[model samples]
Target: MEIAENTALVVVDVQKGFEEAGFWGPRNNPGADDNIASLIDEWQSTGRPVVFVRHDSSKPQSPLRPGYVGNDFKDYVEQRRGKGAGRELLITKTVNSAFLGTPDLAAWLGAQGIAQVVLAGIQTNMCVETTARMGGNLGFDVLVAYDATYTFDLEGPFGWRRTADELARASAVSLHGGGFARVLTTREIVDAAG
Candidate 1:
């Protein structure tokens, strides 16, 4: 698929808090960070719009809560943001969807005349998936870079544990099958961008 020049890359919740493996349990897609970095590089080099979404958890004990070290963006992401300052947009949110964040993602995209969005980031089944669904519903062409997002294992209500890989795969299936977004690998997105 050809990626339009106006497509915005929306990266969600790629914070240091996710490094706490014990807190979030084991995660899948160890190469997610590298893939995300590659996407960021491609977008920046191509002068495409880039939006970074940060999750400032409202829960008191959450690692991503305000004032915590974990609330900071990961080192590499921070560096890229600093280097691309003024050209990139940062959306601070306490929720799952970036579109629901501060400054209004949909409005900003609309103002820029952007009708397509590419999503990447942490918690594949949560923030990334939610943003993709909302973007699609809002009449935007949403593309999810599945390999650039990762999720942790979780225990269900019935005490059944689901692996991180399983959760990530399920999210991709849901997003693509439900018509919320097109799910593609980071490589596919990057190649198409070129």
Candidate 2:
């Protein structure tokens, strides 16, 4: 798929909290950050738009709560943040969907004339997936960089447990087959976007 000129790469929930071993166990896509960083580099070089989604949990006990060390972005993300103002847009969200945040991602994308989105982030079944669904429904062309997002293993409502790889596959199938978004590796995305 060809990435349009009016596309933005949305980085979601890639904060330091996800790095806490106890908080997120048995994750897949270990190289997701490297892939994400490559995309960020390409975007920065090409002057493509980029948006970051930060999850600030409302629960006081959560390590991801604001002002906590875990709430800070990882160095890869922080370096981008350090690039200074107007370089990228930051949207803070408490929920699973980035669109439901304080700044209203959907509205901001529309205002910026973003027609297509390339997504890379944490927790495939949660925030990233929800954002893709909402973006698709909102009429934006959405593509997920599979190699640039990771997720932890999960226990299902039926008491069945899934490995991280299983969960990632399920999410990919759901997002692509459900018509929410296309799934591609980071290289494929960069080449397509190019």
Candidate 3:
């Protein structure tokens, strides 16, 4: 899993709402921050690329609605303020598809000549999955850092509770089996990045 110099790590919404004390708050994303930091460090050192995708929930009831406290990137990510400025890129969107709703992520990737994307973030079955599918459709080889993504339980159409772990694994299965992405553990990602 060698990371090319043109590779980019697409970090999706890891907002405060998904951390230890917000909407989907739970300490479930094992080694998420660490893995992200490791990858960030490697990418920064190598001058590759790191793109941060933030979800700006535009609806009033959504966790990231404007003026809401949970709208901001969580402490772990936000805490790295003032540093890594030019080395990283930040993009915001109001929908699940980071590529469709935001400034052309695909175009930007093409501009950078990026052929590979390593993904990590929260709400594994939602934004993360959506972006991976879009990235694959756009022809980027995608790798999802499994432990670096998390989600919450919800009552689906089946009337059963979908746990965080369940959704996470579901994303892995769907993305990996659907020819969209490869699901790799944090350790695998870190090693690859290194």
Candidate 4:
């Protein structure tokens, strides 16, 4: 449960579109903000790098399309901008995976000699899982903040409507059990950062 100083917190796609009242927003994960906000503050206090990934949908019908009010980050993230607080690295990606078709995040981490990544953000089974797997494959120890990420329910092949909580469950099982990453709670992360 110890978070090393060389660890970087990678917050993936915590945009306003995910927090707003809509189909894409998280309805099952009720306290996602509380978890993510606490981790942000903890990482800031520890002087660790906090990397933010934003999904910019180029499609006209995409939720993060240009000029959309819900395309920006939420209030918790907006209030901390330009304050010169933490080692904040903001990058925007257009794909479901942050590592694919984007700037060199791995190179940036390599330049800083960061060997571990703590991931937290939206779409647990999508972007967060993808980034965590990539980070692990790239030789970085990956830590996934379980409660800090959110995703909407999805329809599967069967007659089952999968919920966000269910998606989160599958993500933890796949990422952690599959050896892609270690899943932890926000409180454990804060305690480790201390």
Worst 10-residue lDDT window, candidate 2: 80-89
Question: Model 1, 56-77: lDDT tens per residue?
Answer: 9999989899899999999999
For candidate 1, the 10 contiguous residues with the lowest summed lDDT are 81-90
- Deviation in Å, model 3, residue 130 alpha carbon: 0.6
Pairs of colliding residues, candidate 2: none
Candidate 2's residue-wise lDDT over 1-194, tens digit each?
78876678899988998888787788998899999899887776667788888999999977789999999888888887635323478899999998899788888888888889999998888899999999999998999999899999888798999998998899999999999999989999899777
TM-score-wise, the better of 1 and 4 is: 1
Q: Local error of candidate 1 at 97, Å?
A: 0.6
Model 2 residue 11 distance off true place after TM-score fit, in angstroms: 0.2
lDDT of 4 by residue, 152-176 (tens): 8787787888877888899899999
Q: What's model 1's overall lDDT?
A: 0.92
Model 2 misplaced stretches (Cα beyond 4 Å): 82-87
Off by over 4 Å in 4: 158-160
CA error at residue 112 for candidate 1, angstroms: 0.3
After superposition, candidate 1 runs with Cα above 4 Å error? none
- Backbone clashes in model 4, listed as residue pairs: none
Residue 53's lDDT within candidate 3 is 82
What C-alpha lDDT, on a 0 to 100 scale, does residue 10 get in candidate 2? 92
What are the Cα lDDT values of the candidates? 0.92, 0.87, 0.78, 0.81
